[model samples]
Structure formats: structure tokens, C-alpha cells
Target: RAYRMTETRGIIHRRVQSIIFVLIATACFLAVSVLLVFAPLLGRLAEAHLEWIKPYMGTITIWRYIIASTVIVIGLFSVHIWLPAGKRRFVSIIPGIVFTLVAWLVGS
Candidate 1:
């Protein structure tokens, strides 16, 4: 009984650690995405004097392009998981992909 309990405890600990890691990763990704999305506005605000923002200004444009592409890819993949599994369900993502591509092109 004691051995079983210890094994269960170990399994639980591993699961908890995995969940923590996923949560941290998710938070970091969200933070980066949010920052990239608002980077232009932030750059404008910091244009006058903020030295730190200057270095990132050029990189932010690249980040915006990468972030937008990442979002579109993720959205397309998500459609499979979100909808009932069927050949027709995959077709649903086409409109979303089209819209995303249009928005990304226009924004850039």
C-alpha cells in the first residue's frame, strides 16, 4: 500500500510540473503576442525619449510579420480540433484563412 501511494504521488507531482510548465509557456507566448500586436503604438509613444524602445523598433516590424503568420497557421490547425471531425469540417477553415491572409497583407 505504501509503495503504491508513493508511486501515485510521483505521478501526481509530474503532472503538476507539466501543467506548470505549460501555463508558464502559454503566458509568455501571450505576452509576446500582445506586445507585438501593439508594438507600433508603443513605438510611437516611446519615440520621443525612450532609449530602450529604439532598439526594438526595427525588430518589432519583423516580430509583427512573424506573429501574424503564426496566428494564421494556428487558426487553421485549430479548426480541426474545434469542429466535429469530418472532411467537410476542414473546409470551414478556408474562410478564416482567407480573412487572416487579407488582414495580414493590409496591416503590413
Candidate 2:
């Protein structure tokens, strides 16, 4: 029963996740990746205001959390809705890539 549910979800989710996953993943990655990409720029700012910004530094560092949360919530909800019973789930890169490309094109 569990296995069946997961397969049903895969069938349904593959399509939807393909449509929106990439855009959201890109958005999420961009949010976190930018900071790492521009670490030198942040270093400059940090030097100028270490004492004040120190407290919120951790929070400010992870804008990508929003993207991650959004994706997880949407993906889980989608699975719950679309999946049948008796199915379990697994993860693989091909599905991820397909989903990303679809999401990139369809989401825009």
C-alpha cells in the first residue's frame, strides 16, 4: 500500500515538480549562492559594522531557507495529494533534472 502511494505520487509529482521545481530551486539556490559568490563584498560590509550586524548575521545568511521551505512544503503537499497508498519513495538525479528543466520553462 505504501509503495503504491509513492508510485502514484511519483507519476503526479513528476509532472508538477517538473513544472515548478527548477524555478523554485533556482530561486532558493540563488538566494544562498549569491552570498557565497559575493563573500568578498560581504566581508567589506562586515568589516565596517561587525558589532551591530553580528547579532543578525546568521539569520541574514540564509535567505535560501525560504526557498527550501517553500519547495519542501509544496513537494510534500503535492505528494500527499497525488500519491496512492502502499507506496514508498526514492530519489534520483535524472528525475531531479527533468523536474528542474520543466519547472524552469513552465514556471516562467
Candidate 3:
């Protein structure tokens, strides 16, 4: 009974660690994406002297979409791979991730 309890505790500990890792990874990915993809667009809009609301109305470029899509795909991939309680194969998760991206694109 004691051995079983210790093993259960170990599993729970590892699960908690994986969850924290996934959260931090996702946050970092989003931060970098925003900095690299949106920062310049915002800077350009600021220089245009547009009104506060109009700045947000600035045209979004294809690069932004590409970067955002990449970030989302990566984030989803990490979550699908890491957050589950049991181990998953990388190949198995690809289809779900791709389907999710396609669904999001179509919905948007």
C-alpha cells in the first residue's frame, strides 16, 4: 500500500510539472509572436498619426497572419502533447492539430 501511494504521488507530481511547463511555454510563444509580428505593425500605425480608434483600423498584412497561425499551431501542439495524463505519439496528434487549425480558419 505504501509503495502504491508513493507511485501515485510521483505521477501526480509529474503531471503538475507538465501542466506548468505547458502554461509557461504557451505564454512565451504568445509573447514572442506579439513582439515579432504585431509590434512593428503597431509602430507603423502610431507613426501614421491616426486617432486612437483608427490605429486599430490599420491594415493587417499577410506576414501577421502567417506568424499568428504558426504560433497558434505551435501552442496547440504543445498543449496536445504535454497536457494529457498519458503519453501520446507525435504522429497521432498531428491530424487533430491540423483539423483544429482548419476549423478555426474556416470559422474566422
Candidate 4:
């Protein structure tokens, strides 16, 4: 009984750690995406418009992009993390690469 309890505790601990790790990683990716999206938009706005537009656009456009990107990353990685261990690597990496390529193509 004691051994079983200890094993369960270890499993619980591992799960908690993994969840925290995922959250941090998701946050980081979201931040990076937000910065990436924000800089170009701000630049365009600056070039075509005035400085006054900065504050107005920052909240509406920048925040929305940050939230949306975060959600997308979370959605994709959730599927990756939830799948069985054997299939997870394939599931996570393949879709990621495909999506990245499509994004680059469309952007270019």
C-alpha cells in the first residue's frame, strides 16, 4: 500500500511538472508570435499613417493578435501533448512543419 501510494504520488508530480512546463512554453511562443506580428503591423501603420495611430492600434490590433496566436499555439500543442507517447512526436512535429511552410508561402 505504501509503495503504491508513493508511485501514484510520483506520477502526480510528473504530471504537474509537465503541465507547468507546457504552460511556460506556450506563454513563450505566444510572446514571440505577438512580437513578430506586432512589429510589422506597427511599422506599416507608422509608414502610412501618423504617430497618434500607435496607441489606438496597439490595443486593438496587437492584443488581438497576441491572444489569437496564443490560442492557436495552445490548441495545436494540446493535441500534441494529449496523444499517446509513441504517436505524439509525429503528431506534433508534422503539423507544425506543414503549417509553418504554408504560413511562409502565404506571407511571401
Candidate 5:
């Protein structure tokens, strides 16, 4: 049966790991969504309290892009490492992660 296959592959024994991964993924998704929802409000607050940064909005936007890209890379790397049935070395997965990010960037 399908259960036997999963058991043999050690997936059944990793219920806790799977749950943790799902929880973390959900948290990350919710965090991003909440950030998006409040971004305008936050921007207004920032502009009101920090007038000196108004002229540098372009530079701040570039930094935001860099930070967002870094978060995406880390999220992709975590998916590559944690979603599989067995252990994976970080170095072994870097190339695939990089390729995936590049493909995503190009596609977008």
C-alpha cells in the first residue's frame, strides 16, 4: 500500500519534522502577507516620522529589493532542504536553489 512505501522511505517517522516545516512555511507566508497589507500604512508612518529619508526613497527601495531577494533565497533553500524524505547537505543544494531563483527572476 501507499503507507508501506512512505514508511519504507522514512516519511512516516518524520511527522514532527513535517509539521514543523509546515508551520514555518505558514508563518513565513502569513508574515509576508501581513507585511504587504500594512506596507502603505508603514510607509506613511515612516515618512511622517522620518522626513530626512524622503529624498532617499529610491535608495531605500533598492535595499528593500535586496532584502526581499535574500529572504526568497533563504526560503527556497529551506524548502530544498526540508521538504525531501531524507537528509540533504546545504552545499549540495546551492546550485539548484540558485538556478531556481534565476529562473524565477527571468520568468517574472
Candidate 6:
């Protein structure tokens, strides 16, 4: 009976771990999804900040947007790796690229 109880506990632990991992991955996916959907707005915000500092900066810091987009893309890729295969994995890249493009266009 004790052995059986131990085995059951171990199994439950594994299942709980899996559920937690999946939940975290889903949250990441949702976050990136929202970020992609609002990328244009984010771009506008970045642009506005740039405009505010243009005088002191003396030129547009295009590199800032490039770097930011790069970081966002890296995060998207990280989450993509955690997502299960099929449609979820395939669709993950689209928004990341769009976000990058929007950042570049709006920043410039």
C-alpha cells in the first residue's frame, strides 16, 4: 500500500509539473499575440518618444527600435519553442516579423 501511494504521488507530481509548464507557455503565447496585435500602436509610442528626444539626441536613434524589435523577436522565438507543434508553432513567427517591420517603418 505504501509503495502504491508513493507511485501515485510521483505520478501526480509529474502531471502537475506538466500542467504548470503548459500554462506558462500558453501565457507567453497570449502575451506575444497581444503584443503583435498592438505592434503598430507600440511603434507609434516609440516614435513619439523619439520625437520628444530628437533635439537633444540630434538625430533619430533608429538603432533603439532595431534592438527592441530584435529582443521582441527573440522572446517570440523562445515562446514558440515551448508551444506544441502544428498551427500554433507555425503561426508564431508571423506577428513577430510584423512587429519588427512596424517598428522599423514607424521609427524611421
Write down the lDDT of every candidate, Cα atoms only: 0.61, 0.55, 0.68, 0.60, 0.70, 0.55
Which residue pairs show collisions in model 3? none
Per-residue lDDT for 3 in model 5?
Answer: 16
Clashing pairs in 1: none
Candidate 4 lDDT tens digits, 1-108: 311222333566768767877787677766766666666676676857686666566576666666766666665565455422333454546666468647955995
lDDT of 3 by residue, 59-84 (tens): 54455656666677777888787655
Ranking by lDDT: 5, 3, 1, 4, 2, 6
Q: Model 5 segments beyond 4 Å from truth?
A: 1-13, 32-50
Score every model by TM-score: 0.43, 0.35, 0.52, 0.37, 0.59, 0.34
For all candidates, the clash counts are: 0, 17, 0, 0, 0, 0
What tens-digit string does per-residue lDDT give for candidate 6 at 7-96?
333566767766876676676556655545565566567768777643533233354445555655665565444332333444656676
lDDT, candidate 4, at 8: 32
lDDT of 5 by residue, 14-104 (tens): 7777888788878776665545455547767788999986887667666656666666777888888766655667788888888897898
Ten residues in sequence with the least summed lDDT for candidate 3: 1-10
lDDT of 2: 0.55
RMSD of each: 11.5, 9.6, 7.8, 10.3, 4.8, 11.8
Q: Which ten residues in a row have the lowest lDDT in candidate 1?
A: 1-10
The stretch of ten residues in a row with the least summed lDDT in candidate 4 is 1-10
Model 3 has a clash total of: 0
Per TM-score, what order, best first? 5, 3, 1, 4, 2, 6
Error of 6 at 52 (Å): 2.7
